[model samples]
Target: MIDCTRAMETNDAPATIAVPQDDALRALLAAIVDCSDDAIVSKTLDGVITSWNRGAEALFGYAAAEAVGQHIYLIIPDDHRAEEDEVLARLRRGERIDHFETVRQTKDGRRIPISLTVSPVRNAAGRIIGASKVARDITERQQSEALRARLAAIVDFSDDAIVSKTLDGVITSWNRGAERLFGYTAAEAVGRHIFLIIPADRRAEEIEVLARLGRGERIEHFDTIRQAKNGHHVAVSLTVSPIKDSRGHIIGASKVARDITERKRAEETLRRAHEELEERVRERTAELSRMNASLRQEIAERLRVEAERTQLLTRLVLAQEEERRRIARDLHDQLGQQLTALRLTLEMLNAQSADQTDVRVQIETLQELARQLDQDVAFRVGELRPVDFEERGLRAVLTDYVRKWSKHSGIPVRLHATPSTGERFTSEVETMLYRLAQEALNNIVKHARAECADVVLERSPEYLSLIVEDNGIGFDLSSVGSIGGGVGLLGMRERAALVGADLQIESTPGRGTTVIVRVPAHAAATRIP
Candidate 1:
């Protein structure tokens, strides 16, 4: 109990008093109020402090002696001074204020959040004269409430499904994220069994999860399938942990489920792609194996045909030379002798017919005809068999052939021979050189409207080279295979190849043509035996 009049007399110390019939109870109540953790105070209707407890002194950072006998505004901040007026007015009206949450000032000039409860104080006559006030610090409570609000917001906005369920598989809480992921609202999912979202095939999985959660075990990134409200399957990766209270007992499980439907689909596509790639590789390997076998067979056949062609060309060349020799022999031996005898017989007839003028004139004309006929046949024989060189070699035959061909074709031809010209070669080499020159000149006459041509023969210690160039309207080298001379060029290459020589034809449109042939010294130096 407080002796209000005595407390009002001096602000130095608290006055002790007693109730009329219950002094001990009054003392206990007074001690309880003074020792309470909340600030308890009393003030007159004029807002003057009449009593201040130790809690008041502790909370406001002022001693009871300093607070008592002062106006209630000693603790009420300037901004909250109006609150005191309303509190006093309510107190005078004998009304009680339950929990007026407001701000108060400590002696140190810091504002502290507090909740105030005020009740009217009345004497034995039941007339209100003063007010009793209790103020409790609510800063920690406010901080805790704000923290919970923020956590709730995070759970509501998360993209992954977050849910809490009791150990018995009953759903306790569902977040907005869970609502979106599972296609069920919080009102629809809460109070429902956890199996509401579990597919039939996955029900056993839920049982295992509950059993594991009962053991206080946490499962991270566990892959599973869940069904949505629409009955579509959702692939999810769940992170579930045991939600424990302050007592450290497993009460429920918290699940964080992420949607992995797209990820799972991507994995399946990659698997199929790998399988297809491997199949294609196997097919390609088989195809390549078959192609290799066929190519080998084709290469072998080409080699055999090429060998046969080489033999045929060699025999053809020899037979053609032999036939030419036979024809020339026939013309020179039979026809030349017979024509010379005829000419002689016609000369004798002319001399013996001196008595007959007209007959003698006819015999003289016949003699002249016979002589010209003999000359024509000899020239034809020389053309058929170019076998005049018993001692002529490669260089001499080529030079002489070039001169004769140019005179025959009326096209100027230049023969550029090295100092080794006229070196006696074997009959084969000599004939090959002659035939090559002949063919080249013949092609010039037929296709090349040339004003001049050059035949160059060069011999080194190791090789021989022939170059034929004409200043004619040249052709495109790229279109050589499509030109009129394509076959002729092929034949020339074949003939050169028979003697182990390299042949090249180089031409360009409007640039003239050049044919080059090179033979190895060992092949060109046909050993004369």
Candidate 2:
């Protein structure tokens, strides 16, 4: 409602009006134009700029003195010059334009977005003289609109359900994500109670959430179950935030629901697997413990049996020695005396028959037979038990035994005795070693067909060793059990064990055979009496 003629001061105005009335009207029009925040200007119908206000100077970067009397097209960009012609044409027809938004150039050639309101200007007779234009800047409004459009696009395309509801728990807005998640269209969901998607038993949750939202509290990632349109339960994680109005008052809430059904199922599977693994571990541990206990019992039983066997072997050896001593005593005391008396009787009979030649020859033959019987008895006694072992030490016994064996068997025998071989040991150790050596020589005579043999008795700081070696036709050691000396070897090993000695046999075909008996010094010293 501005006076266009007074604002522009038209040169064609009449000079007959009262000066005070004109001055007051002109002052009022100037005040209205100066006080407006939008740019206000008046232009002649021919597109000439007639007047400009302070607002126009600020908006278009021009002062009143610089913009007045200039062409209105001076502020119209080259591409939009036809817009000014159209406005002028409309004004010539006495028309007004309301809120015509367009781009206009400033004095510095910067383009500004503005909404223009143009009206035809006239004098008191109502004849059109010029046009008045109002331009308002709308840059901030355009940016806000673009931002809103982008946010709407994101909400519509999100995978998670995004919904907005009033503080009363009634849904106000539903996006595409919400429609897909709940199996409902936006039209069906909007205006409905938000609890429609909650399970019947859990509907009370909505009341609680609404109360919190009213207090402007945000609930983040609240895991819960809900009902789908198909009436099935769905696991979801909900993040609900309070929606505020321009005055900062809580009016509603925005909820984001993410589907977590698969996640829950996977977690349950893992938990079950862990439980099963723990159960298996417990069962296996119990089984192993039982097995370990059984093994301990078995080991104890084996040790007991071994101890009993050692005692039995010791008693058997003692009985054997006693039997040998009894046999030797019988052969020496009874058989030797009888043989001596028989030899003496044969000699006296030969003396009594000296005059009878035939009788003398028969008597001499009887005497010769008696002498052979006595020698046989002595040999048998020596073989039964070598009492020499008790009287003379190991070295003397071995030397006499080996020399007699070599003479009887027609084989060369070499005997090697260490200096300590003369030292006395327990009867059991000496007997065991002597038996082993005897068995070895018997094997060489029966199987080896050897030309020469060696028997060695050596003593070390820790052990006493007896070695019997023969240069004979050897046999495969691997086939010892199947070969000729199986029983003999077993007997040797048994005797060695009784004395706590280690016996080893080494042989190869056509090479030689060697038998070694190694008795620890302490074991030999501690043999049972």
Best by lDDT: 2
Stretches off by above 4 angstroms in model 1 are: 1-26, 270-529
TM-score of each: 0.49, 0.51
> How do the residues 335-413 of candidate 1 rate in per-residue lDDT, one tens digit apiece?
9889988988888888899999999989988888888787668655765685645666677766766776776678999
Tens digits of per-residue lDDT for model 2, 1-529: 6644344322222322222237777688677677677798888888889889888999999999999999988899999988888888988887778788999999888999998888777776778888888888888888888899999989989999999998888899999888878898999999999888998888788788888888889999999988879988889999999999999999899999999999999999999999999999999999999998998999999989978887887787677768878999998999999989998888888889879999999988888888877876786577668455667877798888899888767899999998877888888788888877777887888899899999999999899999999999998887667335534666567768977899999998898899999999997673322
**Global local distance difference test of model 2:** 0.83
Which candidate number maximizes TM-score? 2
The positional error of residue 265 in candidate 1, measured at the CA in angstroms, is 2.6
Per-prediction CA RMSD (Å): 14.3, 15.3
